[model samples]
Target: MTAATSVVAGETLPSSMRASVLTGALKISMDERAVPTPALHQVLVHVSKVGVCGSDIHYYREGRVGPFVVDAPLVLGHELSGRIVAVGEGVDTSRIGERVAVEPQKPCRLCSQCKAGRYNLCPFMEFYATPPIDGAFCEYVVIESDFAHAVPDAVSDEAAALIEPLSVGIAASRKARIVPGSRVLIAGAGPIGVIATQAARAFGAAEVIVSDPVAERRAMAMRFGATSTIDPMTEDSRPLKVDAFVDACGIPRAIVSGLESLRGAGVAVLVGTGFDEVSMPIPTIMNNELVVTSVFRYTDTWPLGAHLVASGQVDLDSLVTSRFDLDTVEDALNADKNPDNLKTIVEAK
Candidate 1:
């Protein structure tokens, strides 16, 4: 416990906290690090749960995702839920016990993108789990009070952690402008794809078709709310016409196929983080007049994500296939290797 005069939370603060650090690719170890103190308008939270994301796995398996390389010891995790144990100056002391979903991005408030309400595109973004930025793969972390969104009683800690991915789905849906009766096609059955499938319905899409080669994932997508599923390995998507297409698979073939599936003047929202670069046919772009775009992390999406889970419109529980403690972080990161697995969580507490 901390010194007598340093008591911040209801319980005595610990001098040190356990962390799972990645020294390099395929290398990780548990280490003890000093607990951090919150700055002004920040809160020291005890991380309760963290969802293993594909980006975390990429860092674990490959040392880097595109240009973001992990050259030093780094903690890899972003999707997180926690309880406020301490509040810093200018923060209300009453928030010491609030349960919250942590938004891992802190964009410079003065950037033009932030001023435009698109902080997700801020060039000065300090994001968690991205090289040089230590994320919440530990017991304690400090976050801006505004970014520590409170979750209602209806939202479970695990569900709260999944809110990060849910935000991506929400962002994609919003970017697609999925209006009532719009026909939308999603090109992946992974976590984001599955979440996007549910999001498509929430946005009032009349027909939400999910395309994946895996029959199992296709079935899972149906359970999540996809009106139809196509095995790109066997079925053809070229004949299908849709108002919007969201590429969550990131597979070149799937993306090109999704592009071919859209009708004239449709929207193509690319959320998949597969290839660093991809080429689209100039003729296809001209003929279809597709408005292609992509979304970064997210902004102001936590409350809506929480509402979807609380109201039972989105099912977060169905996505969890396994759980791990802080010590077994490696297992959590490698969970994507198993096809049967959908989401793996690291329960910090």
Candidate 2:
């Protein structure tokens, strides 16, 4: 049977499935909705794991992020993994039952940026959990088959869910062009910071240092491969110590501090999101001839992320610090906001 038929036929498919829908700022509810059908080129996936992202929490509390505003009630999750249950008309049904991670961004393939293989910059991208596009906080999600990457049998559903953020780390590493033995500094020892540290190590960085105010996060950073963890508030010290720096915290202060931490001609990749306006030492960047790069999201990195986890190179198990059921997504998000939590996931049963 085709994937679509399989979804309809599966005993696991409930008439109505639980979903965490965002009604307004700080207003989320666990409601039931009819299982949706897959459109052409789409596949229906029975969601197994959903990661609670910083962006998800920002939207929940603020009702908007950057240019995207939640004008309507929307489902609020994107980082996810699941098993394909049904395929659309043009999709290959053979993919059914495959455990996969979904790449949430669906860019218009015909866009100029997409044609250049930098689809992450595509202006017409429909990303899940962003304003208009409903996310995978539900039991089932219908997504484009091409965006759903099959995970290796060795990877667990929980690890597969982490592929989303892992891809971001990979993308940031690629953007910075991290070379073997390069001295790397990652600002912010949060989830992305920890993953970026690991990704930089995977890319052969000689020394990886992470800086954050949270002592717990810095401690976790050491466990995740940070050569040193710095508390910027602790003391003022020599700042130009690293060959490359990654601003994974997104806070303006972190970005500014990352710029200060880089060596001459070093590259700094911005991987986090935050307030639009922030002051920086522009003259230092010009004088040092440093390159500053920003990553919107990921492109062509999910499969590699899954591979890294399956091969046991990324150590996803240590990164997933918390998990919640579909009904407690709000609590999960709120908990993640706490400094103690590393990364949180919502499991759909």
Candidate 3:
């Protein structure tokens, strides 16, 4: 079922909504908030599904991530999908019924980075769920019309929200240069890891090996696209001579292990968020002529993510292991403690 309410043309929207707010570390409260009206060139979306990400957990657990700290109350949720319920001036009113996957970050188009087509690096980017930037953990949210990407009917609400993570996987695949007949190794069989496996296969990788400590996650990786799964705990990762290695786990050791497994002239893409300080294998990297790169949030990836799900090249529904309503958002955030769950979805309406 869809995650939000359906509205018709010219229908008057409600005045208020129930908002899930983060007051501090491990503190969450449901409060009444006014429904936001879309501004010019914007559309009001009836929020449906919100995917709980690791960053959300970090904020919930520590009240901060890197330099961004929670000094005031905020909403937390970036991965989202919803249906357009209203439109602002200059927007086509007929788009009110379109189901869309919201691209949470909006960059300043006038910046040099945006002009050069590297909008993800725009210094003035307003990203949702980040400190001082409220996200969509409420029933209604407004976004620029261009950021509300339409999705085909075949994609479920939860799957649509997951496109955010899929976009991350796609970005990593592009950076790592996963091509036909290429052998790729992915570290960390978490949500991003599994999605990266599928993205690699779609990029025509001949073989994908997924490494993880959990037996369940490794099995999940195999189901997604991994030709083989290895338990990093008991197995040595240096034996695999793959052309590309993607670190989705973010652990420093995992990154080092992936580096050790790469072939000469191979590439390594860091996708996971780890410690600010990491020790690189400088000698091995220089000797092998290895290329190491990293990807931030995606750019020009929503349509690709939609197409991948629509065309059946990637399966998104299989990633879900738990679901919660907005009232139970805290439980969804803590779901990672349960090793069996891969993805947790929170319904905003």
Segments of candidate 3 deviating more than 4 angstroms? 1-6
Candidate 2 lDDT over residue span 91-154, tens digit each: 8777878888898878889989999998999999999999899999999998888999998888
lDDT of each: 0.90, 0.86, 0.92
CA lDDT, candidate 3, residue 67: 84
lDDT of 1 by residue, 83-202 (tens): 888878888877878899999988899988999999998998999999899998999988898999999999999999999999999999999989999999999999999999998898
Clashing pairs in 2: 3-86, 3-87, 4-86, 4-87
RMSD of 2: 1.8
110: Cα error in model 1, Å: 0.9
TM-scores for every predicted model: 0.97, 0.95, 0.96
- The list of candidate 2 runs beyond 4 A from truth reads 1-3, 7-15
> In candidate 3, what are the lDDT values of residues 149-199, reduced to their tens digit?
999999999999999999999999999998999999999999999999999
lDDT of residue 95 for candidate 2: 82
